[model samples]
Target: MKLISGGRRVAGNDESTTPRTTGTKEGTPSFALPRGVTLLFAIAGGTAVANVYFAQPLLVTLGRDFAISPATLGAVVTLTQLGYGLGLFFIVPLGDLVDRRRLIVMQLLLLAAALTVVGTATIAALLLAGMAAVGLLAVVTQTLVAFAASLAPPAQRGRVVGLVTSGVVTGILLARTVSGLLADLAGWRSVYLTSVALTCALALALHHVLPPRDTAAPSMNYGQLLRSTLTLFAQERLLRLRALLALLIFAAFSTLWSCVALPLSAPPLSLSHTAIGAFGLVGAAGALAATAAGRLNDRGLSQRTTGIGLALLVASWLPLTFARQSLWALAVGVIVLDLAVQAVHVTNQSLIYTLRPDAGSRLIGGYMVFYSLGSALGAIASTALYAVAGWGAVCALGAAISCLALLLWAGTRRRTPASAAAD
Candidate 1:
């Protein structure tokens, strides 16, 4: 249960005993990560992730432009997601094997090109290809995350990660809203074109501000680096537990988000699309509030944060069950659910980063693969369950998933030493 690094537990006390470096060969950072630099990383990560979600609101418009059927248009998002999943395993590991600053800049430039392709595509297949490319490069967000963790002092890694991750959550929650607004003002193509410009600007900014890795790269081939990423699950018990937690928590998170609109649109409420989209803003507020979880993790309270967040996640369903009866109830549930999910999510990343600072990229990339799977599972299951049963069944399913995560954490805690679990 202990991650023994140099004959002691690699928890809470790492900053005091271990060198303040992520890589054994990599020299220390040139300077402390400035708040402005941290904000840049956050905004960059958020913008990169937003590309994946932009198509969600533009599918109908895209279909009209390409003269494609509704069912066929879903492939735009699906292909993009599939590309993202592939990049986690194949592309993200490169962060450990190369110069991360250069890698991030390269990916950003490529993402801009991909956006351009999407903006100018005249054929359905071409658009799908462009979207896939966008997804592939969007994983620059993960690379930025790993890079940020590497640059931070060991003591402050959790806090920096929390802030950057909050940006990612904000981008996710707001992409559809922004996309819809832009599409309305200009056109569907303008959505991608605007991202192209933003992405190019971010690339230039990051290229200037990102610190160079002063250490030697990992001495492994590309294939070995990837194999090691897979073997990490076998080698590190904490990684395994945290990955499973990611899967469960995000399933619960996505369960609420993927289908909440159905009930809102069909019910006696009959809320407009804009009204349903406004809920994302409420969720973003909750996510932003949970940024404190990272600070608590810096205090070696990750285990405590996860426990409370999961409990709140389960309880949030109570208000959500009354969503049909009250808009106030729905909004409250959305806030609580998003807050709980982000709190635990930040805790998971904070703890996992401690396991392998040198392999931060591989660790986070592997962890997020589970996150993506859980989201897909929840999105599919929630819509199907809502169709067959009702919103109540969907809530039941979400509560069950949250309860399962709680039970898993409880079991893990009982077996793990407090020092190690808290680490």
Candidate 2:
């Protein structure tokens, strides 16, 4: 029950919040995981993130049958964001308290049930409610991230988070692709069914591969977790900066996806749903940026990595202006955009996870609250702008958000110390 030097915490001590008595080898590869572990990560990340976008590609079809206005149909997305934000505040913090694998399994089961309801809901209100439930359980991604951090060696923390986060990035990118294909082949309902299948499979896979819990960190009730999350938000300036950065970036991100399909699937191009999904494949290049950042983070270049990622964010917006000219330009933009977001996100997490290792789950929850808010605002604004002003407005809005995010980063860069920056 002692605090380590240089602000590092050993677990089980009141003064220091890092989990202790976890019996970890400082430099060992606890990441010597089985195939089941990888499968669980892919499935868990895919299913959780997919909940955010399942309805995006399917909204038009839902509108055709349900007779809801586009604004209301948009609630299918908005309600989900609200629910996800709530879950990030309430559920994600539990990872540091309870056993992560068990929590993940339980949430996966709940998500499966929610997806089932979404697949079968016939009314707009019912569908919205189902989407909310789906999002509530979708915070399972936070648990997976915490679990990965807990298993990683300190030296490789960045790489481990980056690797797992790469899975999450893939999920975010592929959700649209998967939904497009499923919506085209079967029905919009089939998208939910696909998530259900993945959720069930991952629940089983994680049960086998995840390690046992560490007894050092004390488990708390939900109320205690909430207090911890709030305390983190109140105490950590870096958390504020990172959260603000996330909001701006995600706003740009949601705005792009919200409006991109409108142009691609309309007027000049008239792309099919499957074709739009194929476009998502271009974002897979982001995995490289994420991996490179991980290596750089270990090499004490987190600040440089974050700065580069932010620069890429600003640079990525230029190609969208050329959508009227070429598809390749849009593809490159998507890759750069995803790469930038993932790199900054992983670097931010590597810095924050060590801030309060005992509260990893709650810290993530607090950060994601702002993330969800940005997403909702972006999606709403993007669609509304596209409604009146066309693709130019949507693309311009996205670029503006990215520019603002960069501004925020620049404003904060000089003030932070070398350790947090390198971390």
- lDDT on C-alpha atoms for all candidate structures: 0.81, 0.77
How accurate locally is residue 401 in candidate 2, as Cα lDDT from 0 to 100?
A: 89
Q: Which ten residues in a row have the lowest lDDT in candidate 2?
A: 1-10
Instruction: Judge candidate 1 against the unseen true structure and give its global Cα lDDT, from 0 to 1.
Output: 0.81
RMSD (Cα, Å) for all candidates, in order, is 6.9, 6.5
Q: How accurate is candidate 2 locally (lDDT)?
A: 0.77
TM-score of each: 0.86, 0.90
Model 2: per-residue Cα lDDT over 1-423, one tens digit each: 222222233334443234222334442224432233444564577568877886776666777778877655556677788888888888888887787878988998888999999989988788889989888889898788877776665776677777778778778778888889988898788888877887888788667556556444575677877887888878988888888988888888888876677778777888877778776778877777766777788888888888888888888889977885789999988988988988888887888877776677887778888888888888888877877888787888888888898888888898876677754
Query: Which ten contiguous residues of candidate 1 have the minimum total lDDT?
Result: 1-10
Clashing pairs in 2: 11-18, 11-19, 11-20
